[model samples]
Target: MEESGNAIGFLENKTILITGSTGFLAKILLEKILRIQPNVKKLYLLLRATDETTAMQRFCNEVMGKDLFKVLKKKWGANLDRFISEKVSVVSSDISVSDMGLEDSTLVEEIKHNVQIIINLAATTKFNERYDVALGTNTLGAKHVVNFAKQCPNFKLLVHVSTAYISGEKEGFILETPHKLGESLNGTEGLNIEIEQKIIEQRLKQLKANGASEKDVTIAMKDLGIQRANQHGWPNTYVFTKAMGEMLINDLKHNLPLIIIRPTIVTSTYKEPFSGWIEGMRTIDNFIVGYAKGKLTFIPCDTNSIIDMIPADMVVNTIIATMMMHKLQPPYQTTIYHIGSSTRNPIKPGDLLRFTCQYFIKKPWFNGDGNAIKVKEITTFNNFASFHRYITIRYLIFLKVLELVNKASCNCLEDKYNDLKRKLNWVMRQVQLYRPYLFFNARKPKLSFRVILAKSLDLMTPT
Candidate 1:
């Protein structure tokens, strides 16, 4: 983990349970744990599956089989299977359900007695996911994990991986301290978790009873999440529900050894476990891909605004360090740390765009016609109206003409125009969902990261 050299030793004989093995952050964390401390008593990966066989399959196909673990695979060689079988085990469990939804009593007992560390990484990262799914997995899921943690008699620490955006719309100086109970980081009154859950459930039940179609249900729930999020002072459903998840942990911690590490816009690995390794398109990666492909010419953003991001490996290192530091300490209160780079080494949107364009110029992507697409300077609009106008003129106008042509031609174009219109509508939805984050220009001057880390890490911040 590239810590101060003792995290691995500290985890020597510990049994650890980690949720969210399928996620990018958890994948890197698992690889690092196995690569660094092979002697760990047992590292259980709690995945969503029907049985252990399916869980193992997912563990192999999604986690260990990825390129991130190539080095470890080569190191273990012929004994790779044996080592993994002995040191790593996958337990099919969904945190959204009660008691982590573990049906196997044998496995439950195994974890209750042997598991000393619990790292909950399971979360729905979709910024515009359905409210029901988001609330179920992000909010109630934390409650279920907390309940399970209480059952773990030997639990040394419960590390809940959260997002730094839990601060919501705060302008500057987002602190690393745990947000106050019953309030958002921005000082907005927080929702009662139990009450909110009941409200969502009742609303969903009413929708179903009213004979709402699935499509209507999805749209209604999406709008509800956004409306609630805006009313609650958060940016979107992802951050809003994650904040509730953190709140649930806060209410339920009850003197347990807990460390909540909130990382910002997690990207690829910086150095360890293979540099520059990343799985799916993360928060900012989508923007990079769309821009490089020339599909996204306009973005609503303040180019000079600082975009905080941290390498995945750095986050993993910090997680390990936090766990190790807390393992030997007394059972204390909850602690939160914001793991990000903006306050220390800020990367502005303009800088990111420039780097992205330059990288594409050096190693451009080829289009379907077998020619490298020439990268263009990104155009940033100050507001959504300007962005919408640009998109309408640049893309929608042509589609509109095609629609007229298709109509005049009596549908001779075979729904091509209709398909394009559908795609454009979908793109518009995504843009709307991402508008606030991309277009934000905080009034608060800046946040001091170095000092926050110094305070949060107990003066042992990673180098």
Candidate 2:
């Protein structure tokens, strides 16, 4: 990461186990820690693979090969292999599976002897995941990992990457603490885990008994997640399950040395291994895509609403800082840190939308016409007409025009348009799955907006 120097705290000669190593946050953390400390004993990256070969393939193709590490590559020169072999390692695993999917005895023994610090970044961030599926991944998966953590003889700290929305509905100021299950993040009563789990399991069983295949069951479950969201005022299964998982962990943390980092919305790096080196699908990327296609003319966010976000590198730095601090701090409550720039670097979604729209106008995305799509300024309206118009103008109009071209010239553009429509619909369905959180009329303003705005403006503007 592009920092002034090292840091106030560091993880030197520490063995760490990381879940979700293939995840966005994990990749940054792994890269930064290894680069900064250089002396950290070893890193055990848990992958959702069956064995070493599959895990290694994922590590190379997804992790090491990314453009984000180009700066470090220059520094390490040809000694990268020796560095990776001596310090970094990968272990095939998944939280949803028992024992973190690490069934390999030799690997387990190696971990038992080496890894002492555990960073669990594995999470199903898709807001629309099914309850059963979410529980399997978010709740049960957490339990499995923590159970594994408990078994670690030399374990010192466990930092769980949780969302700030764990606070749920009632919003004013969300303090950092364990939001125990059956207790809401805002102090409102929440669903009991046992009851919620039983209900989901029963529904799944009914679907199975009806001769539903695995795919059929998944579809059924996804629908159930949507229904659950509607009932609970949440948008999807992802947040619901994560909230539940946080509660369970808070309830069960007991005497465990743990910390929960509740990051609001994570965006691209401000300064890292390199500037503007963005990768993967994220909220910012989605906004960019919408801007490219001329589907997002206006943002449906509060002008003063806080789109709390922190850079990936900053969050990683905070993770290492918190871990290092806990190692030096005395035992007490589970440390909960809100790692968001909304306090010191708030950037409105509307402003972001404006900036993106303007950027794309000069360097526009072209189709066959080599002309950008036309769009008018839009307003925030929850009515069906607003959504219907968007679908019609942005998607339907484009497809209809393609079909017209196909008919006039007898071209294969018709099939292409149909495929594009299918892809767009899939994305919309996923968005609708997490509608509650995104569309929730909650604007947390406990953090200062002016300072954050000033900093963001400075970053957006050139040096």
Candidate 3:
């Protein structure tokens, strides 16, 4: 196969099927493909919906309706809808199910015959997602995708988007390596997928027998996920299941062309489409939001620790370039790419804090009362022990006092005590979920030649 210098040429007249069309990365990928390669044969967006109508509606409202597509809309003007109608097709499918839960045989056959590339971006990103849900959607989900890929005679490549934290809480340089079946980060034994599934089933059955409420069931499941992950030496349920997903795909994808991309802490867009464009509060954004609202006074994090992060647009560009490269020069086996900026352009938590403070000071956040909220420097703790101590002394003690006072006053301050207690619990939970990243010590993920090549070609711009 001859190599082509132009990524646009590789995408020209090529049909691509993308799962998780409603996700942030998927939306950017979709917008980029249509913007750069309008001549592309077709875009098969596989969204989790009841039917094609609902899928199309979601594509319009959730995917294309975002400000990310403003550039394309400007260029296409009145013909944008017509262009999308001709080039895009929304398919209702679920990656967790076999055959992607495709009910329409005709649509399924058309996809199998036409799709040249399949990008598996569907996943449950919640760090503490339920064990059953995470296992089904993340681990077994990759297996189902590979099984479907085997049925596609025209399939050239399958790109599985995964997180770099799937490496777990490690301190040294992480390499671009495949996770062997049953491989555990901390060398735990008997990490069998079948046994794990059985464990989830047993737990659920016991909870159901006890007549657990919906909220209770959710809490139990979340706690079970964390317990299982800890038993297998992983930090959280999301990374543990994702690692298993890679293992399953590698074991089953015999001769299939596969590329696994592990991106670290994906942030807002650096450039392209627009700058500073972000969908929801994610990762460090949570801290920023809390601090801007004068709610966050302290956090558990190592200010000196480097946070490996890459812009959304850069990750999207790397995916496109990787796809083109793999299609042009097919690898002998599955290839892994770690898309992040830790090694090349690293930023410490302290730097991020300073930047946030500087920005908010110039333009302070306004309150509901139309008053500018005062900003203050936040206190950071390097370890959980110190943070816990501070929380107990500062907030928990105050809450205890309030509880005593309310009881003495015959529950007169009940509402205030309840509100304060609820806020404290919420903050503690958020900190616990984000503890891994906040004090992250991972040095950097070693980049592959393909990733270096993409960067060299300016496919991924430095921030």
Instruction: Compare candidates 2 and 3 on TM-score and give the better one.
Output: 3
The CA lDDT at 134 in model 3 is: 94
Error of 1 at 140 (Å): 1.1
Off by over 4 Å in 3: 1-3, 327-330, 411-416, 449-463
lDDT of 1 at 195: 67
Better of 2 and 3 by lDDT: 3
Q: What tens-digit string does per-residue lDDT give for candidate 2 at 1-463?
A: 3232224224667789999888888988887776667877788888788888999999989999998777667778899878888887877887887788888788788797777878889987766566687888888777777778777778778888888776665455666656555654333454567777788889988997899998888888888876764455444577667777777776666677988887877877777765655566775577567657754444333445556777777667677666655654567458777767655567765676667656766677876788766544434445445766777897788888888888887776877877777766755653454344444433334232333233333333211
Query: Which lDDT tens digits does candidate 1 get at residues 388-412?
Result: 8988897788988888888899989
Better of 1 and 3 by TM-score: 3
Q: Output the worst ten-in-a-row residue range by lDDT, candidate 3.
A: 454-463
Q: In model 3, which residue pairs have backbone atoms overlapping below 3 Å?
A: none
Please list the residue runs of candidate 2 whose C-alpha ends up more than 4 Å from where it truly belongs after superposition.
1-9, 184-190, 213-215, 229-233, 297-299, 368-434, 437-463
Candidate achieving the largest lDDT: 3
Question: What are the models' TM-scores?
Answer: 0.89, 0.82, 0.95
Per-model C-alpha lDDT, please?
0.79, 0.69, 0.86
Candidate 3 displacement at residue 293 in angstroms = 1.7
